[model samples]
Target: MGFREGNLGALGHGIRHRTTITTCLLMAVFFVCYTNREFLRFPVEHELSTALDDHPPNTLKLSDVQGVSTVSGDHPANSLTLSDAQCTALFPHAFDEIELALSRGPVKRSLDKITNGHVRARIYNGALYLTDRGLDVWHRQSAILHQIHRAIVTAPSPSELPNINFEFSVNDHPSGDVWSLARSDADKQVHNTWLMPDFGFWSWPEPHIGSLDEVHDRIIKTEGSMTWEEKESKAVWRGTVKWNKGLRGKLLDVAWDRPWSDVQRLNWSSNALAMEDFCRYKYLIYTEGVTYSGRLRYFQMCRSIIITPELKWHQTTSPLIRSAGPDQNIVIVKDDWSDLAETIEYLEANPEHAERVANNTVRTFRDWYLRPAVETCYWRKLFRAWAHVTPPVGQLYPEERGTRWESFILMHRLHWGKNA
Candidate 1:
């Protein structure tokens, strides 16, 4: 009886041990599967076709919907389908206004010889419009127009549309995951705000100094103290300034003078000098002897110094300036203050170079860094930052699924407007 009881007790203990081992093995398998599932999922590709496929069927397509033909393809799960009329309504009117503005410039020149003041501009949507102005209009207007035109030209046409069916799994913890679709680099830059030409310069507040005398007073008040070495060190610390060779001596002599000739004599073309002045005197109430204030001022001064009427003459006459760039938008580098002074003085002395630089300078801000590009980049950066902080949450868990699509759409619209 004792032996039988001992055998039964040992059998029961063995059974309990086996059960515990099996439970642990099952738990390990489940953990491995869950971890692999999180990592093995496909990443979101930001291409147009991929975006259309991955997003919900009701995702908004911001394109001109006119003259589109849709045919059925191998239908995948969650494919987007819309009637011809439904697609047409997606085109934004703001896009049309922009395209009309850009077309006006080319149309005006073509119509200049004709009686019709109407300039026929071809839009990206294959639509045409008439405008009275040229491309040289206000920067803000021109920028908006350019963006609209770019979007129209670049966005894929209806015939080129791809299949919009895809599969998505519900995540147990959807809030921790993020998914977004963006255009290709080229397309993104074309449509996004960061690449807009006038990004940093537009809406720049005007400088605080009203006149050159105020600038001089500010400089003297700021740098009036210290030893000769300190002054030189301060000047060096200031970064770069465009002054004539041996002008340091001249500057020292006139440091206390209310209207220092050095201000007028200071070379504006030297980016180094301009940068130095900005760095040194940025916080000073007076002119730390910097030409303009801020980075925009530095850029403008560089442009002015490089493309002045005198510099243009050098391009035509002297071989030096002509050797700089293929597109004449080249920046010339100088070795020292003397070199800068000589370049500026030489250009000023030469009539041909002077005229070229003058013409080029006038055209630079108008043609290149206009307002539209600036506003776009500004808005885009803002949007991207916002998106990063508060990522979009899609329908996944029961809680998210319960929310209405309209609520999501409304939230996105509100975000865009607020950021704008």
Candidate 2:
């Protein structure tokens, strides 16, 4: 009996020992997993790295994995940084205006067509030369020149630029392949005028509106601070009525004393709301002044539903507006603004839809299309496209034609021409 009891006790002890060993093994595994929790949670990252190792270096660009198309929200991701190629790829419709202008066929307007209020320039041997500044009064030519320089310097292959001569007008009216800030579709059919990105892309010297980037940053911060629900439930507009009395006057009549109206005639002499503050309202009313309003892009920077008439004029960025259905970013009213009240009522009733429209605006303009990277890409593409359509510039005498752009900008007194 004593021997049998001893055997059972030894067996019981062995079972306890094995149980402890099993517990210890489990504890060791748990400890290892706990220590490397983050790594274990994202094992795909390691797998991806391992897979990447098998490929040659430079096989994948940063853009390949982190392109804007991967982004999925209404608000822009803070970490998103698009490469030039990515920017170009993301906004495929950006250069539509340029394409339309070139569609009329290769540029046939001679340099002589550039008269007063215009500038003639050439890109030759990877350098910019300013041949003439045709009585430019507003210093818009300077801004345009600087933007071109900015685009060229930041370009991937600045040293390999094509030799092309072009002319641009800073004035309101431009025709016959002379690059201008904005042109109507009607004007496009009548005139083979090319359109460049507006001067406001660089800066707007008005006290109310400063540089485009600076204003955009301020708007981003302002919009970020407030929730969608916190914004004023009104359509806001402030601009001079005289610029386009037919449209602006009609808007004033429609919005006058309306519960949803925040329209006011802007008084430049007195205090006016800063451009960034315009985002405080839920809706923004866009109106063209004489031609396309330079303020349109700034309004787009806000995360508000843009309300505008059927835009008759085409700016470089006009093609981006989606006016109907789910993707509609801007709200288009009748030219007379007769439907303005009904539209506002619809938006007031359908808050989710309105918010979606606003979000779409931010996603389209501020986040993707109108971004600085996209603008730079557009400039480079413009250069290439223009070069493709224009004749090669003949021999250019730097001294006789004009000054090198580098020297021209640095001069205290900008000489207009050979006479100046």
Candidate 3:
């Protein structure tokens, strides 16, 4: 109902776009051995639970309806502008019963479309039963959910059927026939954060992005109060060194644990510290790990001026820092992370200017990046476009052959229950 009219291409926030870099994306296609469905459910660490428990006071709250109501999938809807949409004001406690049905593929449907990870699908009973080679948890949890949540929130009614329950992997990256489909399809950037916007943060714990507002608030309370001169002079970088093969190690070398630089090997994999713990510096540097770093979103929420190398990957937060723009929200460096020390000194020398840019960084985050409103708009647009192309759902696992669905049910019974 609140749909706004705008151009899709206008979605670019104007950060300087970079050409795709050669990375793991080019490596050999890895296939995941068939595993039990229980693998999809990851244990929620206590620290992660605590960190997310910190929610902002001002988050949007849906009122009026006592509980979720069923909505009709066949209900007609109009296109909306990206700016006019908002995050689902309310979501039901549970998602609809659906499965992402993937079909085997070797046929190249389109030559031009980025089909590396393309998964084809058709709309059936309000669900996008997808056919792909494989599924990855990182993409599904981070990038893919962005679309599903929008549909859940904006459905004609709560009762409207949900779509596409996934048999995604627990591994950091997934392989197999589904890789190409999961990565990209003819037009579905559905799972790529750079191409398709997401929360730009992790939604791993049940109740997506549960602790983000808290992270933002803590950063403000602890770091925002400090004057530029009062804070640590050097830029800070803290995270695990396991996944970020080249960049993470290269970064630590640059900092060399100098008197001013607070860089350390904090194993965020175990759990993240409180916001105050990370927000003590005037400058912060972000480096990618595995695929994309969710920590970048955490860094942006801080009062510190963010510095990092050119981003090889992107998420919902890409456009703001994408291309070097007039307002210095982020100081992007080379992949080698060259001149980090020099850059730190330049910002420290101009305390007033640095602080001003830091303020702009906050505004950029609050006003646009990952805000419920911006996310909502993009979500609506994705479904709106897909409606025109939805195909009829065909049975992915026929009775004559093996059915992964049975394995899914067994896994649910053996491991994860309704609570998970």
Candidate 4:
């Protein structure tokens, strides 16, 4: 009996000793990780290590922009010094859409279809001037103007910009050498319409969706607050059924009463989900509105799998989506959505693959392409590329252009009255 007690005591002592050693080792590991936290962070690819490498070596300082010296440090003009290479690195297919728009040839100004509703503008001596005030629809025209101003004011060589004229349309559909929000594949060849960044990049106050920068910060916080495992394991969507009854309506029918679906008709007056809240679901459904839905970019910011039909309308960053292969960041089902249920089931069964797709979405959109710096870089590139297609006609007259952007914003009481 005494021998048995002695053996048990020794065993207890050994366990205590091993436990102590294990605890110490774990503490040491935690200490090392905590001390080297910065090194352990996610490697940010957008770091400005070699920013502006492709820019002219003698790039002018930001102070060269008129009235920029008085701007606050947080102003966009005070930051975002990206170069062509840096922008291309962040968004590999950045110039694809631009090249497509200008592919036909030098823009024939006579072929341009301008109406009283379209704004006639020009860049003269690196300054934006508006000769005609197009009726602002949902503040789109004004928002576009602000974006142009931002691109010019924040550029490295604002003074050296080419003198070019452009007509901007606030309509959902436009043709000719006019700049617009989006263009369909069918009309892309039929018209010389150029796609600009959505007006929401500046702000969409009526819907209370705020600016792109604000949405960026909000989505980052929301996405980081939850884990993929904790998110609802269902495909989620919310949109008005009336917008595109064929597409959006079909989605509702497919998702109706399905245990794995959380689709609902949007009640904009009450139950509309905040853009950031959509991150709580495992999958997000994207659909095009009249043209391209601006919400796609916001959804791309989330760490959730994007499930959609083959997209008809292409946005500035739409080409980056890889629907197949190892790099597939989005799940593209048929237009009729007949396979949506099976796709959702497959994703639910394969959690790891779904998470990979979600991670890729965040990496492609939030971390790199849709970033503020990339957007500004795209706008500047647009200016340079547009100047190439829009050659000066007969004479170069800078004085004939209408009101300077600074004065136009102040004088325009309808849409830009807030700036005034």
Number of the predicted model whose TM-score against the real structure is largest: 2
TM-score of each: 0.26, 0.77, 0.54, 0.77
Q: What C-alpha lDDT values do all the predictions have?
A: 0.29, 0.75, 0.46, 0.74
CA shift of 251, model 1, Å: 9.3
Q: Write the per-residue lDDT of candidate 2 for residues 1-420, one digit (tens) a residue.
A: 999999999999999999999999999999988676444545444433443455322233333333233344322212233334444434568888877876777877574544777888877776778876677544688888888888777665676666778888888766667788877667345377788878887787855476777887999888886878899999899888899999999999989999898898987766477888899999999999987788889888898999998988877888888999887899988999999999999998999999999988887787666666666767776787787788776776666555688878777244655565
* Model 2 misplaced regions, further than 4 Å: 1-87, 187-190, 269-271, 395-401, 412-420
Which candidate model has the greater lDDT, 2 or 4? 2
Error of 2 at 80 (Å): 14
**Candidate 3: minimum summed lDDT over ten consecutive residues — where?**
92-101
lDDT of 3 at 233: 72
- What shift in Å separates residue 230 of candidate 2 from its native position after superposition? 0.8
Instruction: Give the Å error, residue 137, model 1.
Output: 33
lDDT of 4: 0.74
- Which 10 consecutive positions of candidate 1 have the poorest summed lDDT? 172-181
Write the candidate numbers in order of decreasing TM-score: 2, 4, 3, 1
Best by lDDT: 2
Report the lDDT tens digits of candidate 1 across residue range 1-420: 999999999999999999999999999988987566433222311233344455432242323122333444321211123321222132122122223223332111122331211112222112212222222223333333343333333333422222111111111111111111111123222122111222123322233332222333343344345222222211122213342233333333333233211233333355324232432321111122221122332322222333111221100012212324332432353222333344434654664554454334323322222213322322222222222333243324333232222342234221234455
lDDT for each residue of candidate 4 in 71-165, tens digit (9 for 90 to 100) = 44333222565544444443457568887876766776653444645788788777888766545472777788898898888776787666788
Model 1 off-target regions past 4 Å? Answer: 1-206, 209-303, 307-323, 329-331, 377-420
Pairwise TM-score winner, candidates 2 and 4: 2
For every candidate, C-alpha RMSD to the true structure in Å? 24.6, 19.5, 19.4, 23.5
